[model samples]
Target: MASRPRPPPPAEEQVGQSLSLGEFQNVQSLSLSAARMILHAMINHRQKGSKDGSIAMPETETLNKTLDYLELFARFKDQETTQSVENILGNYDELDTFEKSQLASLCCVEVDEAKTLIPSLANKISDADLKDLLDQIIAKRQFMDS
Candidate 1:
């Protein structure tokens, strides 16, 4: 009998311990705030460019739901705060893009909570450093609120 060819690796989208994002592995990941900003900008641009002063592109139910969810859950609202959070996360060379986005979006108050929520973060950063990062994020959020 002829020898069989080796099978390809599975393309599961795993984010725990280590990332197995499959097709998205090399793609840039955005935080909830960033995603919200981009979507809002696109919507606004489309609306502004319409000849009839109406939405150039029809809004789908999925788009409306996504916008609503982002409005409710996105931690940083304004562009300045969003940029600050991005900058803070970007400074951490230890974290991958996905990890940084997860950290920014979740905005966990404690190191343990962050690690518990983002298991991959457990071995990536020290508890004290993670706590400091969390503090910075919280402080930015507080400043935005006030």
Candidate 2:
């Protein structure tokens, strides 16, 4: 028999209600840092004259782009958009790939700060892909904490 479809994921308001202002700020900082690193890597790659094609930084603040990416990333946690979001991330190969562990260490968060995030996040998100992404983040946090 065909299995049942999952209910639509919580609305952003629902998700937002679950998190505090501090959590949102933390996520924004993390997302911005990741985006900055990716853009910086793209700049380095272009300077190095690699032929893979260039990823252009929009004439926008780094924070804006980072917020855009974070919004897109949240869609991945929605069942409807998961595959499309994954495809976009997979096809967009401009940034140099870093192993999750390496990425985590580079995030430079304090150990206690890292430790507090996992449970708060896990309680709110229901999507599998987001959970996996969160796990990778937690792993990175654990490494940094160490």
Best by lDDT: 1
lDDT of 1 by residue, 30-136 (tens): 99999999999988888887977764888899999999999999999999999999999999998889999999999999998998888889888999999999999
- List model 2 lDDT by residue over 1-146, tens digit each: 49899877653422222333332333323233344455555666665554455554444586567656654543122322333333333432431122222223333244333324432333333445444544545554454446
Task: Point out where model 1 deviates above 4 Å.
Answer: 1-10, 51-55
- The Cα local distance difference test for each model comes to 0.92, 0.39
Q: Against the correct fold, how does model 1 do in TM-score?
A: 0.87
Collision pairs in model 2: none
- With a 3 Å backbone cut-off (N, CA, C), the pairs that clash in candidate 1 are none
Q: Local error of candidate 2 at 78, Å?
A: 27
**Number of the top candidate by TM-score?**
1
RMSD of 2: 15.2
> Please, what is the TM-score per model?
0.87, 0.24
Instruction: Judge candidate 1 at residue 18 and give its lDDT.
Output: 79
Give me the displacement of residue 94 in model 2, in angstroms: 27
